[model samples]
Target: MAAAEEEVLGLLVGAVDQGTTSTRFLVFNSKTAELVSHHQIEITQEFPREGWVEQNPKEILLSVYECIEKTCEKLELLNIDRANVKAIGVANQRETTVVWDKITGEPLYNAVVWLDLRTQSTVENLNKRIPRNNNFVKSKTGLPVSTYFSAVKVRWLLDNVKKVQKAVEEDRALFGTIDSWLIWNLTGGTKGGVHCTDVTNASRTMLFNIHSLEWDKELCEFFEIPMKILPNVRSSSEIYGLMKVGALEGVPISGCLGDQSAALVGQMCFQDGQAKNTYGTGCFLLCNTGHKCVFSDHGLLTTVAYKLGRDKPVCYALEGSVAIAGALVSWLKNNLGIINRSHEIEELAKEVGTSYGCYFVPAFSGLYAPYWEPSARGIICGLTQFTNKCHIAYAALEAVCFQTREIWDAMNQDCGIPLNHLQVDGRMTDNKILMQLQADILCIPIIKSSMPEATALGAAMAAGAAEGVGIWNLELDSLSAFTMERFEPQINAEESEIRYSTWKKAVMKSMGWVTTESSESGDSSIFGSLHLGFFIVSSMVMLIGARYISGIP
Candidate 1:
């Protein structure tokens, strides 16, 4: 009976994965490290105007709570007692800024999403004062000076939000990324909640010093954001606090990581130069550099991979992110009605041998990583009489590959060593055609794991490690069983190089197109304008078809 009780008590608890578009709660079996039960809730996005994307902070909180409760209910149905749950871990979207009143525990305004460009002007103004080389925060913090980070968003809130301003003036305002916000709420709101962020999440803010692993006062002053509002920085693993109430009452919150970093850990990329690419709303590739902060001379970012203890040197990484990967498929399905479902993209793409001469540069919300052009927009170029919907679909899939190739190139340049293979997981990787294309374009083997939910697995691993359920160096084969699909590079080096060359040309054309559109009408719907070009090309193809039918060449 004592042995039976010991076995039951060793089971893992539900980990709440608070993401950008949704929140998920997943329970894992500690012995096998497999998912037992899971639930998800979509979070709504509000685009008030062009370049302004926001989400209700309260809604995120509610969704997180709902996911945990629903997942726990499902667990109970399976006869798994909640008391057997050891700990709760959190993996959240990094850099989505939230500011709230420390007294009332209410958000001052809607949380500014990482994709939002509302703080563009603020970033631009700051850029003038802070040069990208000497004064840019990227050199110190391993992140770029973009509106995607929390610094500019936090500064924007303090300057614009009346309640936030009032709170700041009264010394009652607290600013943090979404993970900190959720942690604060989970631990019991403003009364006595611990305000903290993991090093991996903090590294993305452009305010934290990568070397020191602390918020840089110089950067804080440069952004005009008060340091008092910042949350205490903490390690990715270790007991941060205990849940005060609800479905996870009194459970220790043992692990925390930014979504991407957690996914890296989930993939078990423990060795230096081991990398993982998460194909989510965006595509991010992180290559661990182990203790060395290899700054990117290329347009990649340096970031903290994870921190195990306060005394442990933070693991570093060179990161490259493409803002439009899976999101491009979503756009093709929802906005253009080109496909019935997002997953159908691979099927449609495979129907065509290639994109013909067409190329789609999906710089929908500005380019990131290797190309840090904020003004760049989407473009589908080189359309001809033979171009069809299948070609367009293929081009869309190729866009993800091309962007990932750029990331791999930048990563190699920064790290001075090329990655042998890329470990990939995420919903988008389920598409075989896309994974093959990724491998072909990258000129490297792509490893698609059996478990697509690496983010949640990473969180669970961190929690398990913290609780002494597993060692960090424990064999991944013995832990979470993973079967990999290896997509080897089939194309020759010359062909790959030529394809990348064409991709770069298309990227330039896209960037120039954006500048042209902006200068002409200042219209923010740049994709709409680019689509008009597609229409015009389609009409030309129709005229050519009529001529061919009339016996003209």
Candidate 2:
């Protein structure tokens, strides 16, 4: 009782969760790992083309500021001192590239989102540069050449946007993922802002060496990016800098992680083979692979799980992502006119036993992980006269489960250890129907965590683990806020296999349903095909000649 009282003095930690659709701030009592006060605001996405997605960088930062201010006001209303918030951590949407003028702090263009397919032609050109070896940079980067990463988006911005080009030429442009953008502004914007990104965010960029823990200059040249524009890569935990002008101005902005990496920490998947599947705007299934960087032969991404301190050994994980999950529900509500609310899809799906000979493959921005097919587009196959709105809704929900099953299969092949029970946390997990479907499809038990804000909790955990001054220790058992609900497979293995076989066929049909021209060829300053080929060949020749001259290994 005495220890509890002493611990309650000033041990709250604040987390800023800047996600694809919303920005939020939550305060957690480190003594009990329970949420105290929080606020959230929605952010809009601009879609100018069929397959493009963009967000305003200024709006994103403003959302963060408003969330902080509102959450602090709530803390005062509850009679809790805001000074109890020791540190602030940020967990942001990864791979969304943002560029700004360092001198003016103005965004050069709309932030190109992670799922944007505007770089499809750039990816096609990049793959052609390697002559059938699409994974040329995958050996060092542990990622395939896809429009899913930040480098391609950055390359697209430089090639297409005039303002970005001018800023880069003047040496006043700075580039980073959403986390770095948040950190730079939170620390002090244009006035001595620390431009840095954590290991997890850097690993998603395709410009970072997973082994060396630094930016890969050679790959930067291949992508035609300037190295000087990149930020300093840092570990996930430590005092990044002090919050510049918030209720917690002088407080240290200590922890940072990409959303999925933060979810891994929040799920407490500390041991190798412990995996968690986060169901968010998309589905990301990450299996902790421990310290060694285990590159996957099974089409999974090897990425940094987290680096706790400045000198701590990095932990690695195999990540496989699904491009569309919850967003599919939004599409159904707004575009298709099927459901009234996001949660109503589950109620509609429960009306049908199955999809009734239908399958919806939401390759809306194309497939990710296990099958990096950029040419693929959304498809709803096997539709019969028996199918109706309910069946379509059922198929859509099953589509999410089937995609996760594909990733789960790939993770098993890479790790050689099938998870006993898949741990799940995110907004989509609230659908008990989907959770059961996930278990039924994968033939594994599903353990859904009670934490609604697992990603934010993960960031808060990192913030409180900062050096000697922080309150929390980086351990599994220290958190008392976790509770679980177990979901066992209701269907037999044979039934699951038959349904999965149908899903496989639907996936194959979705592939190559769209044009491979990849759009915007004539308007791109993105290098002509012949010019790009010459550039690659010349760069390789220069690299070989330099190596020979230096006699370096």
Give the CA lDDT, 0 to 100, for residue 347 in model 2: 88
User: Which residue pairs collide in model 2, if any?
Assistant: none
Question: What TM-score number comes out for model 1?
Answer: 0.91
Question: Which ranges in model 1 have alpha carbons more than 4 Å from their true place?
Answer: 1-10, 131-133, 467-477, 512-553
Candidate 2's displacement at residue 380, Å, is 1.1
Q: Over the full model, what C-alpha lDDT does candidate 2 score relative to the true structure?
A: 0.86
**lDDT (Cα, 0-100) at 192 in candidate 1:** 82
Cα displacement (Å) at residue 304, model 2: 0.7
Tens digits of lDDT, candidate 2, 1-553: 2356446644789999999999999998786678899999999999776678999999999999999999999998987778878888899999999999999999999999999988887888888787455555888889999999999999999988999999999999999999999999989999999999999999999999999999998899999999999999989999989998878899998899999999999888889999999998999999999999888888899999999889888999999999899999988777655677999989888977688887888887888988999767676776544556677788888999999999899999888877778999999999988999999999999998767788999999998998854688776464745778999999999999999999999899877745545344423223222222244224434534434212233
lDDT (C-alpha, whole model) for all candidates: 0.81, 0.86
User: What digit string (tens of lDDT, one per residue) describes model 1 on residues 195-243?
Assistant: 9999999998889999988899989888888999999998888788888
Stretches of model 2 off by over 4 angstroms after superposition: 1-10, 131-136, 476-481, 521-553
